[model samples]
Target chain A: QQQVRQSSQSLTVWEGETAILNCSYENSAFDYFPWYQQFPGEGPALLIAIRSVSDKKEDGRFTIFFNKREKNLSLHIKDSQPGDSATYFCAASGNNAGAKLTFGGGTRLTVRP
Target chain B: NSKVIQTPRYLVKGQGQKAKMRCIPEKGHPVVFWYQQNKNNEFKFLINFQNQEVLQQIDMTEKRFSAECPSNSPCSLEIQSSEAGDSALYLCASSPSGYEQYFGPGTRLTVL
Candidate 1:
């Protein structure tokens, strides 16, 4: 069974618009949720992360709105730019999760000019 | 600056040949993990280490793959006998705790 799932395989948005990518996890043990951004051949960089204690985390143009009770979360990219177009992955881990991350299939985002 | 470093951006090998990939985790990160991303399988967890100790590994890792974190050196994951099915991007990540892991660029392995 797929533990964590991201709904959209791809998304397109105009520059300066808001793009929302959704994610959900089946394991209630998940306590740490993070979003990573990857350009073509580069490594994935941590865009934002949130612990279960809080329902929201925002940094710059990226924001993560988490609903612990529902086991769902969404990444909101505000003022979406061409530079933000890439593969975004949602990952989850819990205490004693062994440091191995469970990742989603990923969402490919495109920002049109 | 990239904290986690993976060498050999690409590697191609013939079936039955062994392939090896290495990883250098960020400084002070005690845990390391290996993951595989395939077109057909998506992203899958393989195994992990904590200061040279094997913390957890999947059945696939136990069968044909071997991984180790030698003292004071970078960690490595090696395939004993390569198969076409083994072709995929191998990624390495590290974390201070078991929560947030930072991933490397990933080594793309192509088996003929």
Candidate 2:
């Protein structure tokens, strides 16, 4: 079973618009959630993250809205730029799992200028 | 702008041949993790280490895959015998603590 799951396989939005990507997890033990952005041929880079305690986290134009009770989260890219086009992965980790991360399949995002 | 470094960005190995990849964690980071990403973008955790001691590893890694993070040396992951199923991008990440990890430009391994 997939512990982490991404709702969309892909998402498209116009430049300057907000693109939202959704994710969910099955394991209640997961307390830390992180979003990673990956360009072609490169490894995933940390974008934004939230702990179970916080309902939201923001970094520049990237925002993560987390609902711990629902076991779901969403990444909102405000003022989306063409340079933001890439695959986004949502990963989860818990105290019991140490540092091991369980990642979702990923959502490929495209921003049209 | 991650400082984690991985060598041999690409490797092509024949079946049954040995494949090795190396990773240098970020300076002052004591925790290192290895993961395999397949064509489908599925990530499989291979192993992890804190300093020179291993913390956890999957079953596959305990078998044909061998990994070591020696003190003052770059960590390495070696496949005893390559297989088509082993072809994937190997990613190395380092963490200051254990929550947020910084990833390197992975090494892509192709087995034929």
Best by lDDT: 2
Residues A1-113 of candidate 2: C-alpha lDDT, one tens digit per residue: 99999999999999999999999999998999999999999999999899998999999999999998899999999999999999999999996434799999999999999
Q: What is the lDDT of residue A26 in candidate 1?
A: 97
- Interface RMSD, model 1, angstroms: 2.2
How many clashing residue pairs appear in each of the predictions shown? 0, 0
lDDT of 1 at A66: 97
Off by over 4 Å in 1: none
Best by TM-score: 2
Give the Å error, residue B105, model 2. 0.5
Chain A only: list TM-scores of all candidates: 0.96, 0.96
Docking quality (DockQ) of candidate 1: 0.64
Please give the fraction of native interface contacts (Cα pairs under 8 Å between A and B) kept by each candidate: 0.65, 0.65
True-vs-predicted CA distance for residue B56, candidate 2, Å: 0.6
lDDT of 1 by residue, B3-110 (tens): 899977899999999999999999988889999988643888899998899999999888889999987999999999999999898999888876678889999999
TM-score of 2: 0.98
